[model samples]
Target: MYLTFITMIMTLVGTASSASFSAPNKDLMTCTIAVGWMGVALGALSFVALLQLRVYGYINTFIWNRKPTGVYFIAPIIYIISMSILYAILSFVLPLNGGFVYNNITNTCVAQNVIYYIGLTFMIIQTVVLCLLLFKARTIDSCFWEFRKMLLVASVGILFGIIVLAIQHVHFGDDKVAVKGILVIIFTLLPQQVYFYTILGPPVYHLLRHREYYLHEFAAIVEEKGLAHIYELAGGCPLGEISDLSDSGKPYRTTAVNRLSNDSNFSGNEPAPEIGAPLPRNSNPRQSGPLLSYYKSLWNRASRNN
Candidate 1:
């Protein structure tokens, strides 16, 4: 999300620079040049994000124990920033497109082809690597479907962008408007689809349809802890700690119940029942199962006897 916001801001700055190109201000032109390189930097950062996702997928899919830490996480951002600064400096010192040129008709700064190709290479290589990683990562738990979908959309979008770039380079090279329009369309749709499929769509659906799922799951964990405490007081072994749901290598819905049944080390045919316990089972019939139904039956019998 932070990356998304920063990229959007850079894009807006680049757009504004082109929009106001008629002005004779050197400051704006300088801003244009800087933002152009920033665009390349942003692309590199985006690829870094993709690589991070691919690594996460590997960890989850293979259940790798030792994960990346400290320097592994921070180094990429630093590298991209340093590279962008280096590129900016070199643009001045070297004959990279002889520095940026402002095209009057397009109202945009034409950045160095060398820089453009470097950025394009970054996108292509990362996209291909991510797609290969996805074949394995797709087997990762479905709880991460949103992230997987986000990665998939990003890869597809980058692939499409490459195609667009090829077409623009071959046929529309002389037509600035055609090139700009094609780019605008690709960029616009790519972000919007990513936002919908990953960020907005799933959460909104959960809100509307399964509104109580999160609260219910949290309550179940609390109840499980309370039950464990009670069992400990009753001279029995305390229930094992609830595993972190995020770390669970199972489907979201069954994780808690499965953890309770398997990890609690209960030896009996029945669950540990506390006197005057709050109902922890979900009230929704569809979500209820044999264990929850038994709890409900116990509650009902207790209510009548009371």
Candidate 2:
């Protein structure tokens, strides 16, 4: 599947790089437009594979979650749309007549109103969303956003190039490809940054921030004592979904802390009750060990329920 996708991209690139054959720019333009729309055709299959990976990487199959688990997840949909639009432009819009350089019209106009305009718009949107996701990722876990870190940097460069391209479009009206010098620098120099943030960044962020308990400096601090007291203090807000841990959901956080009330007494054949119990600091130095053990036992039972 991956090979096929690459081949398709190559075919388009072949048509796009008009320095070719007995074929004229018009023929190359016609083929390129036709080839690019193949992305939309393959979008369903690609979407399924990506969705499965996201689901499997998250909680188990027994669990149900929303369509998108995190903000960074937005990148894929944007990519799909961008590819679709970009290919459509290349395949149908044919060659651009001209382009701009800063405020100067470097190339003369070729196509009427270039479809690349739409493709460029999609690319800009994708780049912006990716940057925002990377910037906000530091809140969950510093390491969680690592995958996007490079992408964010790359997106900056890509966006700058796009801006120059857009400036060309403004000046020259998309007749020819503009920013050749800059695109040459960017497309090769920062490909990894582009690919990494788009593909590898989100999952890395999720894995890094997967568990709140794993992050809290207090987790290590309390481990020296015992597990129950730790849970007693911290078990309320689940480590399950860090995305759900935002400050905006004050009620949910409150409910999480107070969830024991929902399952106060063990009811089903599920298991025995082992809920975490809160304790007063000064009042329970002696009880800490046993209490920690109790909470740990409860956590084990709850894990079975989930």
Top lDDT hit:
1
Q: TM-scores across all candidates?
A: 0.57, 0.36
For candidate 2, lDDT tens digit of each residue in 137-228?
33322213322344454455565555545544453333434444334334423433444344445444543553332223222233343333
In candidate 1, clashing pairs total 0
Tens digits of per-residue lDDT, candidate 1, 183-227, equal 654553465356435554554555455434542443344353333
For candidate 2, give the lDDT of residue 239. Answer: 23
**For each candidate, how many residue pairs have backbone atoms clashing (under 3 Å)?**
0, 17
Q: What is the lDDT of residue 187 in candidate 2?
A: 40
- Taking all chains together, the TM-score of candidate 1 against the true structure is 0.57
* lDDT, each prediction: 0.46, 0.36
Instruction: Estimate the Cα RMSD of every predicted model relative to the unseen true structure.
Output: 10.2, 12.9
* Top model number, TM-score: 1
